[model samples]
Target: MDHRTQLEERIAHLTRHVDELSEVVARQQSELDRLSRRVAMLMAREAERELDTGGSIPLADQKPPHW
Candidate 1:
């Protein structure tokens, strides 16, 4: 094939690869956002639970038995 044709093919391949990577990144970002919201909700629930229990120190903040 001619040099110009080879360059065009390479460009097409690279463009497709970039597009695929962009899709993956977009999916990962969506997943991250979902996980972040879930974490925040869990934290809020835990805080509410702590308040209900009269403001006890959260278990997560306590030192382990081995400590």
Candidate 2:
């Protein structure tokens, strides 16, 4: 094949690969957004529970158990 035709074929292949990678990135972003919303909801619920029970942040975020 001529130089021009070979170059065009390579360009088309690279373009298709880029398009596929773009689709994968978009899907991951969508999943991350959904997880963020879920975490926000859980935090809100925990805060409301703390108000009713008068507790502090969970032991996970607290000082060492030995202290």
Candidate 3:
């Protein structure tokens, strides 16, 4: 009930919240790294496919008909 006790409780709660958020950020970072690698792999595969098809320009670089 004292001021000092209330401050200590608030500090404890804030510390716990910060720790939880840090863990969540770490998990998100790990997921982002995995997704980035997967994207790179997919891009490489697509580039190979384009080359095999003997395309002069990549499909991604081609303009759509609506353009």
Candidate 4:
């Protein structure tokens, strides 16, 4: 039809798309935050387990070639 009408239609379509994307982004952000907290908790537990198991591996002492 007319230029102004075409422009209004395009604007409406873009606004609808942007609103949908905003909702999807918000949901993804929430999921990411939950996963981050879970990961942090698991890391803390792993660290505690490592400490309870004496933290690190021990290195054996070795002598030189000479008897």
The local distance difference test score of each candidate is 0.90, 0.86, 0.90, 0.81
Q: Model 3 misses residue 42 by how many Å? A: 0.1
**Model 2 Cα displacement at 14 (Å)?**
0.7
Residue range 11-43, candidate 4, lDDT tens digits: 999999999999999999999999999988887
Q: In model 4, which runs have C-alpha deviations exceeding 4 angstroms?
A: 56-67
Give the TM-scores of the predictions, in the order they appear.
0.81, 0.75, 0.84, 0.78
Write one digit per residue (lDDT tens) for candidate 3, span 1-67: 9999999999999999999999999999999999999988887788778988997776756789899
By lDDT, the better pick of 1 and 4 is 1
Task: Identify the leading candidate in terms of TM-score.
Answer: 3
All-Cα superposition RMSD per candidate: 2.5, 3.2, 2.2, 9.6
Rank candidates, TM-score, best first: 3, 1, 4, 2
Candidate 1: 10-residue stretch with minimal lDDT:
54-63
Whose TM-score is higher: candidate 1's or candidate 2's?
Answer: 1
**TM-score for predicted model 2 compared with the true structure:** 0.75
Residue 62 lDDT (model 2): 59
Q: Which of the two, 2 or 4, has more TM-score?
A: 4
Candidate 2 lDDT by residue in tens digits, 1-67:
9999999999999999999999999999999999999988887787777767877774334579788
Model 3: lDDT of residue 40: 84
